[model samples]
Target: MNTLSSYKHDYGPLPSEVSSAIKPIYEELSKEELLERCAGGFTQNNTESLNQLIWKITSKILPAGSKIVEIAAFVAAGTFNEGVLDLLLFMHGMDLMLARNSHEYA
Candidate 1:
């Protein structure tokens, strides 16, 4: 498995601005606030936002070289379940493609 140091080299460190912004938001957050932010959706709803948030958070935690399937498997290790993992992998793939397309035009 790749180390965190290697991952940082591949993706570049989080920008200082991003780190600064996120730090205060993270620090001031209660457990519920944190969960809500991470969960990413209308309150009391399970929707595409949840999946999108899962992808976003996983992208941060996962090594740059890690496959979406591998990340999905890791996420599925707990209460997330295999079916949900598969869906997440698919969503991650879609997000990656969208990102790539956007970058190509920029």
Candidate 2:
């Protein structure tokens, strides 16, 4: 297993592709807007919002089951960083949990 340091050396930051994908939703927003939406404390609503956005984008381009992994690979290749992989995994897990909760509520 790659250590976090190795991962960091492997992947420096988010990739252009991932940034492009996420940009449509976030890029237009001002810095303050982003802070408003994502700041303060973690909440179910915020988590759901982030999950929904990622799911919407990932579903469009990735096959299923491996969307996050594929995205991580892309990020790793594009940025030579692995922390991005961890971030994607965490986001994916949040998306899954949000989806499950939405289903349960429905």
- Compose the digit string of candidate 2's lDDT tens values, residues 4-106: 4355445637877886798677656646766687676653574465455455545556566785756644544433334334444555666754455543433
* C-alpha lDDT (0 to 100) for residue 30 of candidate 1: 50
Candidate 2 lDDT trough over 10 residues, lowest sum: 76-85
Per-model clash counts, in order, read 0, 6
Q: Pick the candidate with the highest TM-score.
A: 2
Q: What would you estimate as the lDDT of candidate 2?
A: 0.55
How many clashes in candidate 1? 0
Question: Model 1: per-residue lDDT, tens digit, 1-106?
Answer: 5884365455647897898889777777756756777676545444454565456546566565567645644554422444343554555666754455543433
The TM-scores of all predictions, comma-separated, are 0.20, 0.21
Span of 10 residues, lowest total lDDT, candidate 1: 76-85
